[model samples]
Target: MGKVSSAIINTENVYGDLEVAAKASGVPVKDVDVDILAVHTKYMIGEGEIQSVEDLSIFDNDEFFLNPELHIEQSYRVRYYDKTVTEKTHLPKIAIASNKTLTKIRAKILADSEVRYTADLADELENAINRTLLKYGFLIGVRSNNLKNEVRRVASLIRVNGALIEDVIFDVAQGIEPLEPIDDAMIYHYKNKVENADDPNSSVLSVVSENETIIEYVKSKPGRNGRNLKGELIAVTEAKNENAVEIKTTEKIRKEEDDKSIRYIAISQGYVSDEGGVYDIKEKLEVNSVNLKTTGSIEAGLDSDVTINVTESDVLKDAIGPGMSIETSTLNVQGSVAEGASIKARSVTIGGLTHAKSAIESVDADIATHLGTLTCSGEAKIDRLEGGSVRARVVNVNVAVGGSITGEEVYINELNSNCTITAAKLVVINQLRGRDNRIIIDIMQTPEYAKNLKVYTDEKQTLGRELHKLKANLQDKLSLINSNTSSVGYVKKRIEELSATGTEAPASLLNKLKDYQSLVYEYNTIAKHYRTQKERYDEVIAILQKMQDMIFDSKVVNKGRWVELNDIKFELIEPRKSICYVTKENELARVITIRHLEIAGEHIYEIKKSNEMPQELL
Candidate 1:
């Protein structure tokens, strides 16, 4: 990257067409372009002055043309002579040269309604000239830089009225062609570009259909006045028929009761207007025109722009304003709607469920479920509900359902009863719905402790097996001590008598006495019981741990799509003496015998079955 700067003064050199003037002046000019000759009497002078007699001496040596009225006219005559004739000579008569200069005609113009004149005046003149030139089948004019780039020559000084005057004069170039007017019936495939409507490069104008069928149908209809394609009103065939006119125009419409006349005019290129407003149909009238009487009552629209007249025969269903709602049993929605809540006695109706590609908002009954945005001012209850189910993103209620709940998000304030609930995540306020007509409160969990409990159960089982083997070994040790105790007791009695007699015992005698005294308690009470107690405790801990882990795992079951009581981890609240009325899944299908019960984890118990065995009752 290098910084480069040069003082490059680009002066616009005048390459004017001056050679023709020099040739006409008979000056035998060389490379004399863009030069102008000053007219002096009958002679054309170059661009300088010759003042006195001494100044005239140069002309004597050059053999210049001498004019008799040179002083009278204050001009000189130019002549051609050979060098041999070096004296002052009389100038000859010569044809007067025609003066040629660039024609600089300019006009100030405002580019409002007068924009056409400002831009196309020169073009129009050029067209006319070229049309005249077409007779000769030839074209003339310089293809200058001015007209090459579709340049718009703007006026430098604008008038107080927003008018500007142009400075440059442009001539149409040779070989320029005249453009043909576009055919009204020309087929133009629309490419949908607004900027290219007047493009010089475009051969034909384009048109596009936004609502093609609607436009065509409107066109096939009629306008307010009975005008034909040639815009002439003809006599009507059906005189008795009040004119049922189809309006299509941009112009303001006029309706008069005097002549029963209604006018439809097209003012803008696109829009057409009747007595009501502008329309866009380029067609004639279908219905005849008639006077419409004003209804007595007028009501403003929601926006207050459109005023609708209410007649005596008209019916009013509902009217909604700001902070105003007309409560009705039947709520019909034809389009997409976002609402805070809905409470419909009959049903919430929808015309199109396309927007709900995956879901719809509806409820058949208080219990029967579909997708519904349910809201309750008071307590909401459903006794026997059935259907697919509804899962609202938001569920605010003091409510109860005899149905299952499922959706992406589920939240409830206080749910007193429910059949089934399956959700990804659930948050409840106050109390959650529970099974068997029971209320459950404050269900919270911690992940780490649950994991540790799992590990503890596994380790406890291993410890239990080791304790059982250790207990057996202790039993064998106790039996051996019992068998050796009597022999050892005889040895201990002799040593005790000798020591009491004040005699020193032998080394062999002392060793034998010490060994016998070690087993003197008859392999009995304390040692054996201690080992057995430790084994029992280990076994109890292992069983309890295993049970706890199974309960914890089942309490939060998340698998296999549908979960049943048998599928979850189960513990018996009340133990039965003999298992009867057991199902195929090894679950008790009946209470069998009644007892006070308490269970740790979630469980299901069946009370009665449709079929009963005669032998089971006995």
Candidate 2:
């Protein structure tokens, strides 16, 4: 009997449903008998034939077969609770039992203690050293040869006993050690901090400005009296050399009223023309050519057309003529601006030329010129101006001087002047209401200007009479209240005297005392009413002052417009006329209602009954 293999069948040896089991097991589903085997086993007291065997192995020649399948396509299945086959790893088995006794003693010691080690413990120690490095988190830096010594040092510490390395020791030597898994947040934060602190040449500049501008300085540098070019580069203006350019405040050229007095006066020269002045000279003059230059003044004399060229130091009076040309580079002085003379100059001096005695005078300038201080003995007129300041005794213009003009009586149609001025009429101006920043007083002429007069006849008379009447009534009431209260004290004393014997006070005396009490209460009421009336009387006097203040503070009033009291409060509500007024107190407490009327004048109606009217009412 050599080792034999056979597929034995026993019809009576089936355990589960044979057909269903065969179908599930991917074998032929035909009803076939399974193999039965007789074995002596502890599970069965009496050994007989075992019913079924789950696994069937059969050998034919040298090949082995598990279960014969009927279907050509086979699907394998296994049933178990959470059946998972363990994957075989190529990692070698850790054999601590090579020196069994020593390994057992070490294991026993470690089990009772906190230390533990595994097959890749040495590799873990090496990785810890690399992990401690701040830059090793970067893939390139970690693989670099820079941290090789550190890794080797950490590997040497992988002994069975490294004095039970405490967390504090590791914290001091290599920072917080990264254990099994590194926390992403801690790693990222530490990496950023370390990189920021380590980079020496890392310099950055940040600027914020709504308007575009350039910075010309920085606060710190690198050496000697210098600073650490570290910290934030907030603004360059704090550090290096300051190269800010300062603006020079030279005179800004503004449009000015023309100042040259070129009147064609007909003077009585040589008895030919009695009124012949510059007009006679102008008839004989001819313009050679009109050439424009920047400097000097032009004066057309009797026969030549004047072309003025002002220089740094030269007077134009001697060199000007009709049709004659004068040219210079720098302007030092402008020719005398006199009547009957036309002056075109780089600048002008009006100090020598007195203003014309004409009712109206006009001056015009095309280029830059100055009219120093114009003293108009009478009156003058001016046209368009480019620049300069004018101070005139009496200045009047056909059009408004667009620029500034300072004068005693300056008349302008359209211009912006910045100064103290006194004019009979200032029609159109903006921000003329004095500003606190600038010292300017705009005293507009009041429409009811007559009311501002200092005549106090009406006010004094009215106030004096009211004050006298109020004082008299108040004094009389005070005297009467004092008399009645004194009488009440006397009556009380008498009643007490009568009741001294412990008997009730005489009825007559009690009646007299009750009368005194009534008089005292009436006195108090009258005193309170008089006080209120006195206060109201004072208010009537104070209202006049408030009305004056309203003329200035309120725009509606200050605009010099007529505003009736009805416009202030549009709707008027009049109390119902004497329709048996009902009041909270039925003990004859009078119900006074206010009735407002808006007629031609403001009036208030009193709806008091005839009996309730004060005896003092007229």
Candidate 3:
């Protein structure tokens, strides 16, 4: 090839609507078709400036408006570039050749001009070499992606004006060395990726579901011998790898073999563990303790079919260290949990004290001592609680101290410290040893009560007003229609009489008839509106009353004697909270009762003290 260069034919553009563009380009209306890679459009936001891209997605949003004009500058890229060397002056001498068998390809930039390289140029170089290889008996052994990469390297060196690349080895080989394995081996394929522990988002413990593919086994086949350029058979002198091994999995990992291949699946959802080159999915992972050095973050997940057990139980060490989180199907801890440590599972049991800053969420929880945030959907049994937030459905505590307890039903054996207790239906305290306590009969989230009740109450009032107005409006319309009935009858009779004599009725009589018909239609519409609004008002009133009934079912009771110096306050948290009562400075009582009632449109909270406990607060 001769010296080469790339050139653009023209840069002119024809821009306008269909007819205007045809006229500008001097093309006939029927032949005004234009060929372009893309239509350039501008999208603007507000009046400040035009913000757009070649992509039309930017203008797809309703916030951006289309501009009338397109951008003037057109971007261009070189697709195929090449230059032939024509007696180059101070450049390095180029060299290239084919081996005796034509089974190797080692070459460099043997041309002159080279700049930006592209896929087209890479294809040209590969196709030329393929033709030469096809002429002989040798065939290409290097992959297509790798071959193109090497071809582009030639352009890379020319663009940098750098030193020559070594041609001693096969850069893009015509045929790789012919070899065969001495013995066949089993190849195992893992389904999941194992990431490094240092990666913050890395899930070092790969999890798998029951009967899921954890490893696949396929028999390795020996490579076929190759032929040289002269059509000569080549022997397999050297082996790729002489190692041959068989699969050996633990009892937890089940292996199934078919006619085609073999696959190892997990018996249960668990962590992928390996031992002595064998694969096994451990259903239960037991560790002494969880910390940065032991287990960075054990997150097997709630549905991962894995169980985590922390066995360390001394007071000095935490079962789960600071900032450690364990999410599994089942969790058990024998020792205390440290600050910033979290445990989440289907069921959690902590045998030691929980740090104040940590948080635990589970379906069922059993903690010896808690000073952390524990939220459960099922039940919680705590030995001692102090200065932490606990919310569950049914809470049973032996002794509770300075913390907030919320549930559907709460039972505390002894109230030894100041605490805030909120229960939806019932609250029972066996003993009140300290003071400054708030026992609230919580109306919030009391199924179909609280916010829904308020909504229905307001709706009932509005509907009542509307129904009254509609009834008055309907009556007025009916009265107007009745007053014009006789006039309408007289006008219709006069028209009929005139028609019998073959005479046209006066326009005044016709106007009176039409006015009466319009009044009747208006009256019927108002009557229907009044009836619908009255039914809706009755429905709203029923719903509001039902909600109020549910709210009153909640109660708070003190079962044991109230300490002499203790101050306990009872509260009801309805939409409008009501303070039931606050005991005297040195109040003494056996069993106290607090109830909510609405009499004469007033919320009456009654505090009755008795020696007997309230039966409803059981």
Best by lDDT: 3
CA lDDT of each prediction against the hidden true structure: 0.30, 0.28, 0.64
Off by over 4 Å in 1: 1-449, 500-503, 517-618
Q: For residues 1-618, write the lDDT of model 3, one tens digit per residue.
A: 012322222212322243454454454545432222222333333354654355533322212211223121232121111223222123333334566545455654454442344435544555545434433433333222255677666546544654334332235554333556444334433424444555553344677778887776554446555434332345554434444457678898888987545778888778888778788888788889888775677777888767788899998988888888778888899998899987788888999989999999998899999999999888999999988789888898988988989888888999976788887777777777887787776556444355686787778778888887887888788778778778788888999999999999988888888878887888888788787888888887776656555645555556655654344344443345555566554355555556566799997776666665556555
Candidate 1 per-residue lDDT, tens place, 489-608, comes to 776777788889987777887886666555444345445655676766667576554544332221211111211222111233123121122223232222112122246864434323
- Give me candidate 3's TM-score against the actual structure: 0.58
Global CA lDDT computed for model 1: 0.30
Provide backbone clash counts, one per model: 19, 30, 0
Off by over 4 Å in 3: 1-204, 217-246, 251-262, 445-530, 564-575, 585-603, 614-618
Q: Estimate the TM-score of every prediction.
A: 0.21, 0.17, 0.58
Best by TM-score: 3
Judging by TM-score, tell me the better candidate of 1 and 2: 1
Worst 10 residues of 3 by lDDT: 72-81
lDDT of 3 at 131: 37
Tell me which of candidates 1 and 3 scores higher on TM-score. 3
